[model samples]
Target: MVNSTQVSYFTLTAYFDTGRLKHLYFLVVLTLYILIISSNVLLIVVISVNRSLHEPMYMFLCSLFVNELYGSSGLFPFLLIQILSDVHTVSAPLCFLQVFCLHSYGGVEFFTLAIMSYDRYLAICYPLHYNIRMTSNKIAVLTAVLWVYPFLSNVFLVFVLTVPLQLCGNLINKVYCDNYYIVKLACSDTTVNNICGLVKMFTVILGLIVLIIYTYIRILKVCFSGSKQTRQKVFSTCTPHLASLLNFSFGAFFEIVQSRFNLSRLPNMLRIFLSLYWLTCQPLVNPVLYGLKMSKIRNACKDLLFGRKIYL
Candidate 1:
């Protein structure tokens, strides 16, 4: 149990006590990470080189690939190191930085998805104007916001880390450093931190939900007014975006629930697995979902794998 009154820094270590299970876990996670890196990098390269795919949708897909790459990089490398070394202990400052990186990337990714949805709405609803509206300047501005907003949010979050937290037990139940979990161990009052976190969560997740839903509704309205062929084409184009959106939504929802709810009644192993569902499983699934569902991405990947020249 972690208490808030201890003086010395506590080191929390995570390990798979089950020998075979440990090996399996490492193998599985390593394999998934490799797939994630390869697929997303392939997507990025394909988009850059394939002139036919240099449109708004593929451009947004490229952005998503970039986000996933950074997000996974922020997460898995440290996890891989810890798993291999059989050590889970992290210093207080290090833990704080980890939390900052996780949240920052997450917030940015959420915002980028929202932007992508709006892009789709424009393309489907006002095809004549989409190219104009989603011009290089506009995309640049949105991309800049995606990069800046998260950094600012993390800067604000760092204030919460300054509060003296007594670390009695250093063991973090989850695979990675979570902000709420770390905050719970702080000896100082964390009302402000909690409030800030809630604000950040609502600002990113709730805001994106509203924006995405609005865009989809508008898209449906436009599709309904179009010819059958047009409607089918629109639906086909939106399918990949919808799949990506659902994956992100489900992953984020459970993560928020797990962090808020006290699962003290459950066994530690179960709790850890539940947490890993979001942190590990969800991220690993994103690139796969995109690659499998998006025909454009699929073709791009084929060209990449087969050593065909990618024309931009």
Candidate 2:
């Protein structure tokens, strides 16, 4: 109601009066959280333990799984607490931390997918040179960049742009902490935040789009010209990667639409789903997509759980 600095807690108005059914909702959310954690951790452990599966692609997958855990941790616990409690408010410091964690998850996820596409491009287009180009050292460095760049960007957004702003109100319409919504609440001028945010979003999207498009186009060329064996190889590996990319993009599109546009006319249920979709679905879906689609991961998971040895 006053300044942003004075608003130490933000009231989340998006949560409805669930009444007695709050228990049921809590159970459902808890179950989903458990599933996400179990599945992602399983895949990460499978990749790390199986030395044979520690190639560039799977290693990047390990990083992806780790980010899923990171992102899910930022939201689910908060949701569970709010579901049971009457007051749906979060401290400003905790809110900023959540924003940072979730934003970094999204950025790292996108960057990781782009790098995975490039990895596929190399393996398929230049099989002989894939190892030489995507060496262990280079893979480590690229992985580091994906995490570091996103963290720094989010740091700028949350700490530099948002934390210092004055607020006229403490009500956030959505369930979780969002950088966009936080920026929107600024009683102070947000000209720089808007301009910088748009530029950052467009620059990242455009560059990654070009990279993904070029890699896929080249991969397609190799697929058609190469032998049946080559085609099969590309199909197996690239299928899961493409599936993951499309899945994440769909959820992310809904999120961006809700953030950028005025969608308050929509049902609260739909709006809440739109806000949670990207963070919730990606973590749950990725492990399933990769675990079931990638033969080695599938077998490895089975071997880990069922106590049966299988060769990759």
In candidate 2, position 19 carries an lDDT of 92
Task: Give the Cα error of residue 28 in candidate 1, in Å.
Answer: 1.3
Error of 2 at 75 (Å): 0.7
Candidate 2 Cα outliers beyond 4 Å, as residue runs? 308-312
Q: Which of the numbered candidates is closest to the native, going by highest lDDT?
A: 2
Predicted structure with the largest TM-score when compared to the true one = 2
- The alpha-carbon deviation from the true structure for residue 122 of candidate 1, after best TM-score superposition, in angstroms, is 0.4
lDDT of 2 by residue, 1-312 (tens): 467778889889999998999999999999999999999998988888887898999999999999999999999999999999999999999999999999999999999999999999998888899999999999999999999999999899889988889888888888988888887888789998988887987898679989999999999999999899989989999998898899899999999898889997999889999989999999999998899989989988889899765444
Query: Candidate 2's error at 36, in angstroms?
Result: 0.5
RMSD of each: 2.9, 1.6
For all predicted structures, in order, the TM-scores are: 0.88, 0.96
- Poorest 10 consecutive residues by lDDT, candidate 1: 1-10
Q: Please identify model 1 stretches exceeding 4 Å from their true place.
A: 1-10, 13-16, 159-171, 202-204, 267-269
Please write out the lDDT profile of model 1 over residues 1-312, one tens digit for every residue.
Answer: 344434233344435565657667778778989988887887788889889898877877788788878878878887777776655676666666777778787777788889989999898888898888889988889888988988787877764343355454555667788767767666556777777768866877678789999999999988898899989888788887787777777777777777789877877777666666655654567677777877877887898789887684
